[model samples]
Target: MPPRTEAHAEQQPAAVAVGKATPAAEVEPPGKVQVTVGGAEEAGSEGEDDDDDFDWGAAKHIFVLSNAGKPVFSLSGDEQRLSTLMSLIQGMLSLCADCDNGDEMESISAGSRRFVFLKRGNLVLVGVSSSLVETASGDEGGEGGEGTGKEEDEAAAAAAAPECESFMRLQLEYLYASILFLLTSKVQGIFLKSPGYDLRGLLGGADTSLRGIIELAEPSRGRGRMLAGGVETVWMDPAIRSRVARNLQAAQTASAPSGALYAVWLCGEKLVALAQPRAPSHHLSSRDLLLLVNYVATQPALRNAESWTPVCFPRFQKTGYLYAYIGFLEDPPSSTLPRPPPQGNADQNSPPAQHSDATAGTGSIADENEGRRGGSASADGGTQSNGSGSRSIERDSGTEAGGAAGDSCVILVSVESSSEQFQAFRRTRSALESRFRSALGTHWDRYLGSGAELEREGILTKFCTQMKALHFHYCLRGKQGGAPCVTQCLSSPFVDHELASNPAAQHRVWGYYTRAALRVRRGSCQEGRVFCRRRFEGNNGYFGGGGGDGRGSGSPAEEGNGASEEELATALFESDPVHSLAYEVGDEHTVVSLFGKRDGGAGGGGRWVSSSSAGTGRLGGGDELHVCFPSSVSPEDAYKAAVRLTAIVRRDRDWLFLTGTGAAK
Candidate 1:
């Protein structure tokens, strides 16, 4: 796939036809094959593809499959069928819309089912399913939701550990809460962290990063059988996530968990947070730098846990303040390592009625004979590619970002590098968060002294200490009956979006972190396959090659002139969320982000003066980039650009027939 040239015109709104799946390319030197870029693509309606009918009966099949008669244990076939059905529906939503123009369609899963839509795009979707025992959705069998509120309230009150309260309540709420009603005509798209957190329906007008995160996720894929079991929101103070790092050190356990609890959640292309744990033994040693460097290469990716490995986000020492690297995927690339900003999602104070997380107001009216679960499409997640020019990465600077990570969680690096790391880190962190939550709930404070809260909760400090040292590396992802998961897009049912053969349109695939994850138009059909597209642009041959010579693919007319770089590539599929949709241009492959690439793609994505420079980061031989809408551009430009893109790759085609059916004869 070519590097993802997400050079859409964001200043103004425009309609953009979908692009295609190209591999993430590598970067070389400038004056060579350069991928010139303009503003982000315009916005347009992504007309829905043909969708398969929803199967409402699978729920019963699932109950039978479990043989336990306990519905919760059984992943109802009906749900899977509906999920597949919804994937088809929302995936092609734009085609169904009356408006010729389209909206952003970010993906978010609230309740049991996953969802697809846009954040600010033209479409929105809301999905609900059952997996979480008490999450926003409910199941008929076993220990699912339907528990008494009095019992839950009592449990919350009596729970000795403050942390435990959340588990008890979270589990129940996950099961019982009705899907919310955030999706409105005005909403661009709603992105739910997961069913557990998505109490309300799809929210309207969320941040662009939310859109970006999901867009980069499965452009059109989901796992109907899988479940992201955990809380959607973490109301605790930010410090808590970091503080645990310092706390790890103070305890002084022997075999400390090699990794810390660093988390990167770019749910909808938003680089949420990258927090590393700090052990008491942390030092500015080479080994530490290596660990940091490894992770440095991590966070800039799409933040999809399924594809990459995780690093215990390092922590700071001095102040109880554990510094973490936090930013929105939309932040400018030229800016400094950013501090945490306020939340950017839709209204959450009082979750919607369907998403009350208590009782599903009234049971959803079922058609009985054809029991299709009621749902909607919302926020989305995904994965895709790398794009850019070239770079002879020297080991010296490659480790720059690592050394600078420091004891403080402050991870300072260029925008390009950050984007890549964001992709990888987000994925790992999401997996960790989900797994950790499940572990703690199932183990019931297995780590005794691990935390003050756990200590007080009647868990042995020794056990807690031991528990904190290790983690759930997602070893069980595919342990069910076969090998483990390989990429983010291929997670069994819940995440599997039957791969479509159409061009790379909105919310079609599951991996790589780009905006594709959020663009489900509605009524799209699945092709059931993983795909790869290779697209390279012949540089102007600036690297001593013939000027204006075509080196990549396409023809003379397509190549054009003005020293355009090769079309960057990206590997977008249907599964995987919170990962990066990478891109690289010019001779330098560093991420040219609005935050740091102030010189435009000029300076090699410079390193942080501090430790971020340790590693000579090679982001597919390009600069670290962060897409930010320039205030100058007009929304009209975006609209026009989108229209142009659509025109470039329309779905159907026409040809002159030798003779008309009747008239010809």
Candidate 2:
């Protein structure tokens, strides 16, 4: 394989790439379908990671552009390179490897999410299927543009090939897994705040109202029909399932709102399955989920709702990444989505001639620091502090690429919450803001609004509403060094600790995070433990625990009291699974289903039974039961990984740090 690095792409100019068409034009066949940057491929170095640190070398930033050739999203160095490159290949294959039956466009990877936006400043990607993918005359046929119509000849002209789908899936897998993986160094978010360039508009009309943030998009056709809820997936490979599960669990702890909590958990190929009863008041319909996805699509910092409950939550044996982002720690307290001034009808115009100079291989990550003179973070839509928090300019810059005159765009991310239910939310937001300020130190924008003065001058929102109590907003500047995307911070445990330990306010806090395993234990109310009362808003119910668990003590005694025979029988069978060899063991008592839980009751030796049900008159079952998980991992390995992470966090005092040698190799 070739080395994976953005530096390699810099060799080619941003102008006309074979796969990236400037505008719709007539077809001129190349007569061949091939994968080529038409240059040498760069290989990435590898290292052993004993802890959080995996020696990533110097970083670079690369751009991800839409088919129109406008940038959609951007990432730092190596990681960015990998993301963009994969996108290109997959995008090309999407158009190239497709077969059609002459008349309409037929896509192998068809779904509702085929919408494409002409992104200007950020990294957003969409793959579209095309006929005559190799034709170059489409955009050059004078004004209206024309195509050879060679692609429309027949769907049979092409055959379904696995290469494109496989490649695209793998790339999605990487991003869905870790956007920082290919990085030779810690990835930064500096590109998010660059001025001049137009980032895609974050649409915010109403608060995202799933259990968390909802992702919504106004499809060109669907009046309101767009992807809602989480991306459905099938997880079959054991290794992949474990990895995705671990990461998803950790990222959940980082979200601030109702978030993407697992109301229903179905785990097992051979284990006993059952539904956990979630609170009756917390039922969320498919509509509820759709709303959440809609909301998320409009938020900032979060590029996508990656951890939102997946549409296909428990796909038994297929391996893939499923999930979405709902509420984020940093959300818009007010309804002000960030957008750029349109140069005209934005979607219009054949994108600029693919100037070879704009391609990742030839484009320098940063322009000659030339016009990088100082500017106010408050200029137009900028970052500013609230209350007595004097504007420190913390850091400021002017690296943002804008229109012909070369101006900068502004963005504000609200960190503090506006509610009393979460004073902790406010404090943590402030701390994160502070860390961001410090991280960008010399690179912060001088103009714009901070936590307090956003709406006064910048394109921003404040944290406040009937949902909560206070007001807070954060300014994001895409400067030379002010790492902009704070969401990536979830990878740091120490940072999480600092934010989690706010002394100002408190209520229920759990079920959210960005890294590490956060096993949400359904606490017993009778045990008097305070279970953070965040509500669930989906179909699934919660389940698990044996008969003697929480359920055994709560059944009613009325003559008309109802207990379905199926439910009662399940409960009875769980009490003595030893009597039946066909049962799988698991708990069913304290189950709190989110979407929909599993089969009836719990089974396996894992079930708990009271002496009354066991026929042994033991009347004894411990509240705290032990379950064994067989892993190839030794206790020592787990200990080592934990200790290593702790040490790195202590040394760096930052949530993100390097664990392996400082060298790339």
Candidate 3:
């Protein structure tokens, strides 16, 4: 987004630079060795040594520790060695509380680094980041005062500090939520019983989950999912989506427990379908869905077998645990295996057939373990244990011939765990798989097999062709039965290939949109705003803009103070066009449109393309569309393309979004 501040420039080296070797005379013999957590480098034998070696001030660092000063998890360094730092953090909070009549410290700013603190139950979460506030000195007017330029700049920085701190706060909140997802709020009881309890011992295998959340929360990697608080969805045909939903609904009705809340179907990273309770208030939130998906994607163990885990959806109910029965319906395709045969019309009355080859090929540890445990299938479609006297059903292979290959289909059901309903639930899960596979038939292979590729070649291709846009991300927000729901879509190439080689450029582009979105939400762009840099005549104007260069007609400030919405619309609709335009349409929508050419191209010059369009719109309204267009495309042309895209979305809105009760489509 904005250029790195002076602080980032100064501290960046510490984050990436390797440490110099100490001489034998200077270096002391190794003391009691501390094991590194999550494969991170040891933070050193002593706190002072750790501080000297670790660049805590450089990259973002997250710490979850007990109020008793016990380190739980450290994102960057060894928590055991960082125990001293954890104690210092606790001391600061205690000092703040004692001094401010129990008012805790929320955030602390030290030069370019900012530390934000959050307390949940007996635990304290801390986030330290070098990310600083955008100065905006070139655009925002300086308040009238008899102060030096440095003083004014400092004041501006102080005023903008809250924005960066808020982001850090959000990161900490997500981190805490992830902990709750794993341990539930009941973790508070453990802390209450034993304040010095080592939470790390309990969270032993959750390193990947915690790290995945952190990575996704990072601005550069997540690409606005955390900022927008929404999940990316897989775009599919309305009819097929409807069928998928119907099957999920049937499964939920036939098999789900009375305590069932929601049943979600996911293919890879994108949500495919969801079946929630009739009460819209009971629906799962986009934020929870995003977290759940990320957690699943990160945990390879989950892919190998069915799991019964206690997951907390903070938005739904933060106080307790919801039992999630997560199972993969199909194994992700591999190059070595032949594609599984389509669903067969086997007689329902026939005995269940065993597919040992499919189970072996899929490499399910649970199946092998169960086989060793003397687990056997009963006549009633449930597994009976001969040794432990426990009951569990073997997850349906969902194939008559061999292991299914393509996108892995994950079915996650959230319900209250009960011993009596457990067996029935397992049986229901098997039946649901049968019903779902039967409904999709050959289309299952076609869609899950090559759905992503098809999307790139299908509607997305058509839209990009007409709009001349390089990438697009759209999140539609609305209320269903008074609960907020969101549907989102991202261009295929945007996530995978386009600009893949140039991460800095991609970050810059996304950063522009994110900042513009924040500004629009804050009502700062009432008269519209333009963010562009005039460098080398239309060379990546949006990304390359704002930095002062003595080449353009007007100062950066003058260019930023763009025309009013009405005037800008007139200019775009008519003849005159601008490089960047940001305006809000009433309270419900905000649009930020940018046009620019990449810096490097085939002939020493690049074609300007419409880059980004972000806004909220009412369902079925043309104004609800968010799109990106090529720089060559005029505003009018972009508008027309948006209209076309809107129509397509409108026609498929039911399937596109997880709306009301059964089969929203």
Candidate 4:
């Protein structure tokens, strides 16, 4: 039987009456109890209550509409039901254009809420955020304290507004890019030709993907990759990754007329390997790659069965579409397959073990069987017991081995679609799958296991003692004259006791990092300069006072003499130790470092000297390095720690980045 497609699944009734069940009577006369229909009393009441209780004012809202005031999509609430609000937004935009002498409406601030408008051809996208810190009212302050305090507050508020709006605009751009990715940029022309056209119809059911993109855009989710505009690669053994890449290349070469332009392998959200055309210009851009990853991840139906869909890489070529063949590698059926007998108990009738060195003389049973069977095992392949113990051997035509049931590994191949070309490509896909499986041995079970080993050997653990932050994100841009690539690494302690016990501290730490990232990307911050900001001094203190005196040793009293409140605050800001820092190193690189609260007062005093040569000299001119440090660590110590971390990353660049030739050498 063919696999059920999403549309077919959706068309099936949610419930069926197996045994001639009848609906209960709607009402009973007088004192008789009323009969509930379908045995669902207040069936959707909880959902209704959830919708009613939802804090719409607090959550971010994204809306897409036509110039003719037709609603297309809304991140929150139903777009069709929100027609009045959409119409008002359209009218407001029209007023802005009419009153401003044809100028476009970019943003509008009303108290704490800000609305950002982005117009693309005949469509309009508006993003609304209520999370902005409200500007303090001047009337609240006494007459004597009004001047400098209010001015400073106003300046800070002004700085924050633009940053929030800029990020909102970026979110809208991603939303619009997602639309263009689904239906090429020609969508604009479609709307231009017919102003009253309903775009939602053309979008089919892509709103789910757009909603996912919005969720990822949230500060607490997606992390630095969303902010840095890069893709996060799966961490694997360099040798294994290289072998996978080489096999992908070999597969492409085997099917010479396959028309396969690019092949990508993904283990969940992280990329395992990618093989693009030798031509540098044909590579996928980071933005397009991110969108593609999001699409695959958001759509559960894609995971259910292999799919051939048309996808457009807007950054690659907005005018054209590429046919993508996406298939998930199935795990070998170990239960039904014959297992070799235990060591020392092998039956006399079993064939003698033969060494198989088809690829690199690994002597694996799967490889040996494939060789003996002339590269094509029979329907019922032979099983040989090795001295080690009972082990399952995969047949030549069976599914690939390794990975848990829940684990997902997908292979995506893209090519220009054509009747003859697609048929040829289908055959190539089979050959590629076979070769891909043959390249990976049973060792995948060891490497792709629980991932504890990966975390232990990862950069986070390597420098956990030195850089004591809760989270870290690193991006390594491709070297000069190579294909544009951005390799990313993100780590956070999943087993940290303090973070697990104190949820607020976790939220605060991420907030600090998010704000620092915004500051780094803001236009006001000059390039090649390190940006540092102190964490907020709340009652719970950093890390919920898990260890040590949460406050640092560099207190205002130690600085000598009587100090004013402002002086003390400044001293605390400089010495109390914050969790995040941002340093923009030219146009193509950035380093955002974060720190957690200290454990046992580890870091101490050091002078912070701002140097003009800090970015180029101290940072080692790398792509991006984001780390976390203890809150008790002084700013100067954090800076020095970041420099040390950069040196360590530079030394291991080969293992960290996936470069032009293939996996990192």
Q: Provide backbone clash counts, one per model.
A: 271, 147, 9, 7
lDDT of 4: 0.49
Q: How many clashes would you count in candidate 4?
A: 7
lDDT per residue for candidate 4 within 396-479, as digits (tens), equals 343344332324444445565555544454455455445544544443433333442353344345344434543455555433
**Local accuracy of candidate 1 as per-residue lDDT tens digits, 372-433:** 11121111222322322122111122322222111112232211233344443333333333
> Given candidate 1, what's the lDDT at residue 85?
34
Q: Could you say which candidate leads in TM-score? A: 4
* Model 2 Cα lDDT, one tens digit per residue, 1-665: 11112111222221122222122221211221222222322222222221122111211112344333334343333323343343443454334323232111111221111112212123333333222122233234442234535444322222211112211222222221122111111112334444223223421122222112211111111111211111211111122222222323322243355322321111110000011113322222222222323333333323221122222211110122223312222222221233333221212222332223212121111221223333212111223223232112122223221111101111111122233213222233333333333332233322111221121111101011110111111111011012111000111111123322542111011101000001212211111111121111111112122122222211111011111222221112112112100111112101111110112222211323332342222112211111111133343432232222222222221111111110000
TM-score per candidate, chains pooled: 0.19, 0.19, 0.62, 0.64
Q: What is the lDDT of every predicted structure here? A: 0.21, 0.21, 0.49, 0.49
Ranking by TM-score: 4, 3, 1, 2
Candidate 3 per-residue C-alpha lDDT over 466-577 given as tens digits, one digit per residue, 9 for 90 to 100: 3445555544443332333443434324422555465534543444454444343232321112211122223233212222331221111111211111111111111112
Q: In angstroms, give how far residue 425 of model 2 lies from its true place.
A: 23
Find the 10 residues in a row with the least total lDDT in model 2. Answer: 507-516
